[model samples]
Target: MKLDKVNWENYYDKIKGRSPRPLLRAALELEKETSRPNGRFAIDLGCGDGTDTLFLLENGWQVLAIDAEPVALERLLAQVPTDLTKNLQTEVAQFEQLTLPPAQLIHASLSLPFCHPDSFPSLWQKIEASLVENGRFAGNLFGVNDSWAVNAHMNFHTKQSVEALFANFAIDYFDEEDKPGRSTAGSKHWHIFTIIARKMSDSSN
Candidate 1:
C-alpha cells in the first residue's frame, strides 16, 4: 500500500476497539515500579481515536492528547468517560508547529514516523526537552527496512540511529520486529522499533 494513499478515517475506525499499545503498557508497569504518585501528566502524541488517551486518563494521568486532525481529537474526546473528562485536554496541532509541555510520560505509539523528515529532529528534541528528568518515553519508530520507508515525508531509522537519539536516555526496553503485519492502512512488511526509555538527569547525562 502506498503511504500517501492511506485512508485515515477507515484506519481510525478499524483501530477504535483495539487495545492500548504494548509500549504504553510496558512503560506504565515499569514506571509504577518507582512508586510515583498519580495525577502526574502525560502527552499523547497523535492520540487518534483516544484508545491510549482513555487508558491514561483511567490510570489517573492528566493527559494532553494531540493530533494533527481535528476529527481525531473529536473521536478521542467523545470516547472519554464523563468522569474522566476533567483530566483530559485536547489539542489540534501539527508536529512542526507543536509546543510541548512538561510531562511524566510522553506516549506516541506508532505515530512519530509520519512526521515530515525535515521536522522530525526538532520534534524529537522537543519530546526530549518536555520530559521531566527520569520521565518515561513510550513509542514506536519505523525501521530502515520498513515497507513504508520509501515515503520521503516519513522518518525511518537504523538501530544505530535510533540508539543515537536516546543518548541521554536510560533505556530499559528496546525491541525490534521485522515481520508481516496489518496496519490501519493494510497488510505490509513491518520493520519497527519499540522503545521504553527514561530520561536521565542533567548530571547523569
Candidate 2:
C-alpha cells in the first residue's frame, strides 16, 4: 500500500483507543528487571494515536512520539490524559527524515515496515546508533512472505535477514507468525515478526 495521507488518516481513525502492543509490554517488563531510574527516555516511532505513548508516560517514561500524519498526532494528544501530557513530546515527520536521539527504549510497533525500502537501511542504522548500551528495541517487522512484501516501496526481510539485523543485540523475545490472519485494518494473510531485543554490552577489541 502507498500509505498516503488518506490511508494513514483512515488507519488512525480505525485503530483509535487501542491498547499498547504486546511487544512493547514485554520490553517494558525487561526494563523493569534492570531497576532503572523512575523516568527513562523513549522514542515511539510512528506512534499512531499514542497507544503505547500513553502507556509509556503513565509508567513515568518521557516519550518522543513521532508520526508522519498530523491527524495521528492530533488524535494522540486528544487521547492522552492532561496529567501525563507534560511528559510527552511529538514530532510530525517521516522515518526517512527522522534523526533519532540516544534513548533507553525505542518502540516502533508496526511502524518500521512502513518505511520506504530505499531508506530503511539508513533508518535502521540510525536506530541502532541512537541507542545506549543495553537499550531495548521492541517492534514488528514484515516478513518476505507477507502480502505487502510485493509493494517494493516497503521493506520486508527473510528470517535470516531479520536475525542478522539483531547481531549486535540479544533477542529477548522473538515470535514469528506466518499464516492467514486478519490485520488490524481488516486485511488478511499477515506475516510478521514481533521482536524485543536489548543491545549487548560493548567489548573493546
Candidate 3:
C-alpha cells in the first residue's frame, strides 16, 4: 500500500475518535513505575489524528507530533484539549525526511511500516540516534507475513531482522502477532510486531 497524503488524511477521518494504542499505554505505565520526572519529551512519528499524542499530553509529556498530511495535523489539533495544546508541537513531514529531536520516549504506534522500503534504514537510524540513553521506543513493525508485505513501498521485516535492529536496546516488550485482523481501513490479515524497548544505558559503542 502506497500511503500518500490522501490515504493518510482519509485514515485520520476514519479513526479520529479511536483510543490510544495498547502498546503505548503499556510503555506509559512502565515509565510511571520509575517515578520519572514529569514533562519528559516524546516524539510521535506519523501521529495520525494524534490519539497517542493527546494521551501523552494529558499525562504531562511534551510531544512533537509529526505527520505528512496537513489534514491529519488539523484533525489532531482539533481533537486535542486546549490545556494540552501548549505541550504539543506538530510538524508536517514524511518519515523519510524526518529529523527527530532527542526524546525520552519515541512512539511510532502503527506508523513506521508505512515508510518506503528504501528510506526505512535511514529513518530507523534517525530514530535510534534521536533517543536518549534509557529512552524507550514503543511501536509496531509489520512482519514479513503481513498481507501488505508484498508492497514494495511498505517496509516489512522478518523476526531476525527486527531483532537485529534493536540489538543495542534492551527489549521490555516484544510480541509477534500473525493473525487475521482488520485495519481501520477495513483491511484484513494483519501481521505485526508490537515492541517497546529501552536503549541500553551501558552500551559503549
Candidate 4:
C-alpha cells in the first residue's frame, strides 16, 4: 500500500532519536567475533531515519541505507556525522523494487512486514540470494496475531511460517513478542519476531 508522504515523515520523526535495534546490535557483536571489520559491507533495509545505519557506519562498516520514503533518507543524511560520510550510501525505494548487492550483513529491523504479501516471497528469496555465503540477516517479521494483521497491505506470519522463512539458514537469535505494548502510534497487541540468522553455504547444509 502507498503511504502518504506526510504521514511517513511524522512516523519517522517520532522515532528519529531512537537507539539501534537489538537484533542489529547482536549481529554486529557476532561480527566482531567471527570476522575482521575492514571493508565489511552491510545493507540497512528500511532503515528509517538511519538509526541503525549510523550505528553501522560508526562501527566501521560500509552501509547502504534504504527507505521507501525520501524524507527518511533526507533526515538520515542530514544527521550523519561528517567524518563517516565516506562509507555511507542511500536509496529511496520500496521493498518490492529493491535490488541488493552481495553483502556480509542485512539489517531490516521493523521493515519487512510492510512488503505486500504477494511480493514478499520473492523479496525473501532475493534476501537469501544476495547474502554472501554464511552472511547474516538481522530483521523483524510481524506475526499473524499482530494488531495490524487485519491490514491487507501489510504482511504477517504464523510461527510455523516464520520458521519456514529461514529453512536454509541457521537461526542465531529468535524472539517472539506477543503481548500488549505501547508504540509511537498507541497501545495495541504486538506480535513481532526478531531474528538473526546466517545464510548457509550449500556444502555446509
Tens digit of per-residue lDDT, candidate 1, span 1-205 = 4578656677798876899888788888887775555447999999888899999998889999999989898888888889999999999999988999888899999899999999999999899998888888999999988989889989999999999999999998999998899866668889999999999974332
Worst 10 residues of 2 by lDDT: 1-10
> How accurate locally is residue 194 in candidate 4, as Cα lDDT from 0 to 100?
94
- Residues 49-103 of candidate 3 have per-residue lDDT tens digits of 8888889999989999999888778888988888889899999999989898888
Model 4 lDDT per residue over 1-205, tens place: 2232337677787886788887888999998877644358999999887888999998989999999998888888988999999999999988998888888899998889889899999889888888888899999999988888877888999989999989889989999999989777778789999999998874331
What are the runs in model 1 whose C-alpha is more than 4 Å off? 35-39, 203-205
Full-model lDDT, candidate 1: 0.88
Better of 2 and 4 by TM-score: 4
lDDT of 2 by residue, 48-108 (tens): 8788898999888999999998888888898789888888899999999989878889999
lDDT of 4 at 74: 87
lDDT of 2 at 108: 95
Each candidate structure's TM-score, on Cα atoms with residue i matched to residue i, is 0.94, 0.92, 0.92, 0.93
Candidate 2 residue spans exceeding 4 A from truth: 1-6, 37-39, 184-187, 202-205
* Winning candidate number (TM-score): 1
